[model samples]
Target: MESGTSSPQPPQSDLLDVFPQKGLEPGDIVVLVLYFLFVLAVGLWSTVKTKRDTVKGYFLAGGDMVWWPGLFSVLMLAWIFLPIYIAGQVDMYAGAIFIQQSLHLDLYLAIVGLLAITAVYTVAGGLAAVIYTDALQTLIMLIGALTLMGYSFAAVGGMEGLKEKYFLALASNRSENSSCGLPREDAFHIFRDPLTSDLPWPGVLFGMSIPSLWYWCTDQVIVQRTLAAKNLSHAKGGALMAAYLKVLPLFIMVFPGMVSRILFPDQVACADPEICRKICSNPSGCSDIAYPKLVLELLPTGLRGLMMAVMVAALMSSLTSIFNSASTIFTMDLWNHLRPRASEKELMIVGRVFVLLLVLVSILWIPVIQASQGGQLFIYIQSISSYLQPPVAVVFIMGCFWKRTNEKGAFWGLISGLLLGLVRLVLDFIYVEPRCDQPDERPVLVKSIHYLYFSMILSTVTLITVSTVSWFTEPPSKEMVSHLTWFTRHDPVVQKEQAPPAAPLSLALSQNGMPEASSSSRVQFEMVQENMSKTHSCDMTPKQSKVVKAILWLCGIQDKGKEELPARPEPVIVSLEENPLVKTLLDVNLIFCVSCAIFIWGYFA
Candidate 1:
């Protein structure tokens, strides 16, 4: 049965299935509530006290950080892709909880409630809050996942027992001929069959790398973290840390998932449509709930709650990041493009409001996500990304490295790539993937071609399109090439002479924040400013009440209180030079990290 769907004629067993016999106990509830309170407190406490009124301050957290951690690709993600991803996260979270706990509506409501709590802190505190909360969540996630990994290993008799039991963990009701419920032959391998495996070896090697590039280097969500870094060294250091951290999922998440099937094959590996639906409301499989099921069944009460918090932490971390980035892209890139004269205050408001819009849209898209990719969240994410994001990755690669790439070339390449991707996307949506025992009626393009392979094709086409178009178009000017391309990045900054304002002073001010006026216009502007000051004198200005001040504070608006706004600082150019010792240390760490990653892949292969 579809989740959240009710029957006109109720079955006699409806009441018995209304709630799970075992779920969060009193201790669990207390722990979960405490975690929620702590998260909210972190969000509230992390709000930056100064400079949030400015666009730079709010979205970028005042652009001052010792360590932490793009418009076209951002726009694509914000308007088209992010909502779907967010929906997937919601589905994953809800499914995790719902599969073992409560009714679908109650689970969805809880998810939305969590979203609201997340938005409260994220919108009010901006990126600073996100960073701070993310730190806390990361800790919680690590602790919980590591604890679960230990338990899972112990329960399964370690790696040797896991490998032996995984193949034996089969659903009794699964069809023998279909290979529907059987454990994968290549489950232990990272590099699998080039043609037959779900994640083909060639596609995983080449195809996955494109989206990784877009995500790591170009996508707003990831790039924003690095942008907040104090300097290039900090950014590189953060990247190094993240590279090492990425390898943890294989042991913590993937192996634990396998352990779940080994422990409870009847539910986690259930392949019969009716049995699967009864277990998790996804007829395709219940593998998505493996982690949560393990958490609930294996962990004790307080720990189960901690594990729930971990699940929630993971969800909120992702949601908050996406929310902030989407808001930033919409407010700074899209809305600002449409309303060039929009004030910083207006932009801030729009950014916060856009978060709400995202929440609504993502909620509406949940049903679609539930039905897609055999109800597998990971597959849905990877498949959709493969369809749409390879073009963006290719475009970013060319723009950064190739001096010939002009706006026109990039524009046409994006359009062509998007059109092709959309064709495939639409076809996939229209003709959903069939079950293992069912006839595969999906178009041969989708059935025969894996998403990873499609991503490779999409990226190649985009690369060719961009190169050809750029070659045919007028070459970019020196000004455009300077300080923009990879080759020209180290060139010294050159200031150009300011020209007399061709547009009106207001228009000029709107465009560049500082007005560039001719002598006559300068005098006129001064006179107008003087008149405005006289008209809005201190005696005539209304006093803000205490309540108003509190409201503004909650909204993250700084109260200037008769103080003059400071001049905006010029953009800082971070020196790339790192101390030799630090550089050597980082280099060694990089080598170690890469070697470890390769060793794992080879071992698994």
Candidate 2:
């Protein structure tokens, strides 16, 4: 059963005593400090070399785009619908709450410190720093998780012993607790009864896929990474790498959770509300305690510290990413729209300022998030996304594939779907899930209809509304759309149609089978690309230049002047995934990933 509240008490000191655990040792502190220092050093180093004033340089990691239309969809299908990002960190917000309760530390202080660390690196080096730090975090996360998994499996006498203990505990829990705060007997099962299961079969099958699609394929937050790759091959290769990484969560996070439940049933699976609250400070349940609890309880001092560092790395990595992206979107897309003539220095300053603003907003939001899902981090995030993302997914999928999807249709469809979802969100907040022992006196629709199911209904509404509205409106001209859509991306004719009608510079003489461009035409062509496609800096007045130099120096940039950079080719947003070798590799990888997923679901099922 779901439960939530508006106010959360600070984590209790006796948290470590909940399941007979020792406090963090000095080595743990040293490891954590070292990790923080390393990340800060790397971020600042990136800042020294970074040109933060430019859009592509700042946000895109100075890399180009590679569009994916398949595996990312599958990637979404795996934990979210696989383990997914800031959301990962926000999910960890609940984790932080648990850690606070267990370690008896001030969670608010931890939150502020993390925000400070994340913002500093993020504001300094921008996207590149986020990427590099993420790589290091990934390695640390993998090592820490695998190390703990090994210990957990050994402690429980391996898989066979794990299952025996878990089912025994599960059965005993039901006998005593009955329906109150007892996990479903089909807890390990991924696909179960749509109506009764927390993860309904129907919702798992189709409903959750909608949001995953939006997140993996469409959301700027994710696609930004793909766009940062140098070429399409590298992009797909990066995706394949992500595909491999996706396999880690179940083994590392989810299964370890089950192990913890078995090992500390009295605490992790505390049935009584008062007893449960006494254990980890969440009356609803202590399911969120599985990770940090295991790390603290199982691992010895040094490894425990390393694991702590991993958690912090994950938290910081996610936080920095979120801050970087929020700032990028605000500065590049929205700010530019508001001030088209804004100078580069002004824009960079605004973007860094925006990161600070986001930190303030996130800090303010921590209490609401922790309380909303009864300290269940993943659930809170999913419930929120189910309300907001399905409509966006519907618009994007339709817009990309269907030529008839027009701006007016998208605008109104989004407005309608959002209004509906917002109504649900407001209601969900007002009618929070009651404690397990409390009467199930919730509204039928709110109580019975799952968020995943609602996702579908909302998506369907958006699609139909958009389609019907488009039919009545004036269709966009083929020329206006050009090669932006899947329907037109491949044909060179449509690609040409997208290009403006100005005379392209002619190369007069043939040299080594390549035409040599005339000097005048080449110069003319460079200016055209800068003005039309690239984010080039404008010349500043003497006084403005002096201030810009001072600002740049303060931000650790080398110079006040613009650098002459070669024009890049226009980005290809949609491409046919028709390469034989690449397709073969992807196919093989997909099969492996899917097979692994099926094995996991079947094991749990």
Candidate 3:
């Protein structure tokens, strides 16, 4: 960040604590620094390999963007938490990793350093660097997780042994207090009490699914990876990879968390606020600390260092993905809108600079995020998304499928839904949840109604308002909605209408439907077009110095030599594979993924 502030400490007031307190040893520090260096090297290498001067190269690598399944987003979570919380539509986990942070380390060091490394690689190599580094990060995460998983299974015996002991622990906990605000009797079950449980069956299966869909399917951060892939086969394979990886988290994180509560019930399942404060300094039980604690207590010193690197890897992977994607949205979508005539080089520079500003904003938000929901990091994120994201999900779904959704209806619907969501968000912070034993002072809707349930209500309200307003207003043109909605995605007629071949720049400069142009307007238009050509063209090589050439080489900016870039025509791509063998494999993998999902739900139902 811009200022040297105190690093965030592990939750002292309310998060759960388990590991024997320790500082970063010399080995850990060395390993972490080395890992950071490696990531930086990879980014620089990628920058050399991939084009980066254009928006597409920087944001999407040197390939086409596509429509990837939401499952694709959460693929890395099992390795790092199986994108389960992410698949489950959890928010940024930079804060989650800090729940059981190391002793004597500044929170800023972890958060800021992570963001800075990611930004360097992103700004240097663009999306190519991020993807390759993510691959390495995913590998490290799985190795670290499996190491902890092995230790946990060994510590508790096998699955059957753990289950037997888990039941015994739950029974004893119940004897102390049936309603002890500790781990629930149905802790292992996915379908819990509709009103009392943290994740009600109805909410998990239905309400939470809304925001989850938006996160996986529509969110820019996750989709950016897919868009960088070479073709439809590669994208589908990548999503299948996610599904395959997802099957491991319940084993990697969830079961390990259960084992934590069973083994260290006093810490993970603390019932009294005083006892909890003594344990993790947070009155909330410390399930979030389970995985980290397992690593610290079980792994040897070198392995501990490796796991630390893995945790850092996970943190960096996520932040980089988010920062890069956010910059893309800001530079292309928002910036381009504001300055429609701005040059491509200007867009690239602004995008990189925007990442630094985002880093500062995140650093500032850390304190506020830490205080939210009393230190339940993942849940706080999920609930906020519950309040704000369902309406966006509804709008996206309708805009694509229902051809009548106009800009006015979409814009107004967002404003209306956002206002209501914000009211709930503000009230949540102001009238905070009371201590476990104390009476809740908040409104019934705030206190009693689950945020997931609120999401459904908000979604219905948004959809109705949007639909009604659209019905009374002008409809979106067929061309406007063409190839966007599900029904129209495969229509060859609409697809053909979407993209036209490029014409000579001179012809395009004066080819607007209004043929009659004033002499002054024509000259001004040519001047603007010629200026754009100069900014993008490499014809200035004879006048350029060594420093500028070096900067261009390092950033992977390929000069256009003698050829000017044609104004691109975007084509609607069919994501399904055409190759018989690959298509068959994809179909089978998809079926297997769905089967696994069904099996998990049924086993826990």
Task: Give the candidate number with the greatest lDDT.
Answer: 1
Candidate 2 accuracy as TM-score:
0.81
Model 1 over residues 1-605: C-alpha lDDT tens digits? 45564422111222113223358778987988899999999888877553466778778877775453211111111122232354335544554354236223465676677778888988888887787788788889889999999999998789988887788787666677787887888898889999989899999999999887777667777777777666666666777767777888998999998988887777777778877788777888777777777787788878988888888888788788888888988888789999987866678889999988887777776666777757577888888888888998888878878999988888988888889989999998898888777898877898999999999999989988999999999989988888677788787778666655433444434433456667677647645655565545565445777888776776676644222433544656657678899889878988998899889988988
lDDT per residue for candidate 3 within 247-303, as digits (tens), equals: 898898888866665665545556566765565556655556666666666677767
TM-scores, all models, native as reference: 0.88, 0.81, 0.82
Q: Stretches of candidate 2 above 4 Å error?
A: 1-20, 49-51, 64-92, 98-103, 170-177, 493-584, 602-605
Give the Å shift of residue 79 in candidate 3: 26
Task: Please give the CA lDDT of all the candidate structures.
Answer: 0.74, 0.69, 0.68
Report lDDT (Cα) of residue 549, candidate 1.
74
lDDT per residue as tens, model 2, 373-397:
7747678888888888888888877
Decreasing TM-score order of the candidates: 1, 3, 2
Model 3, residue 190: distance off in Å is 0.5
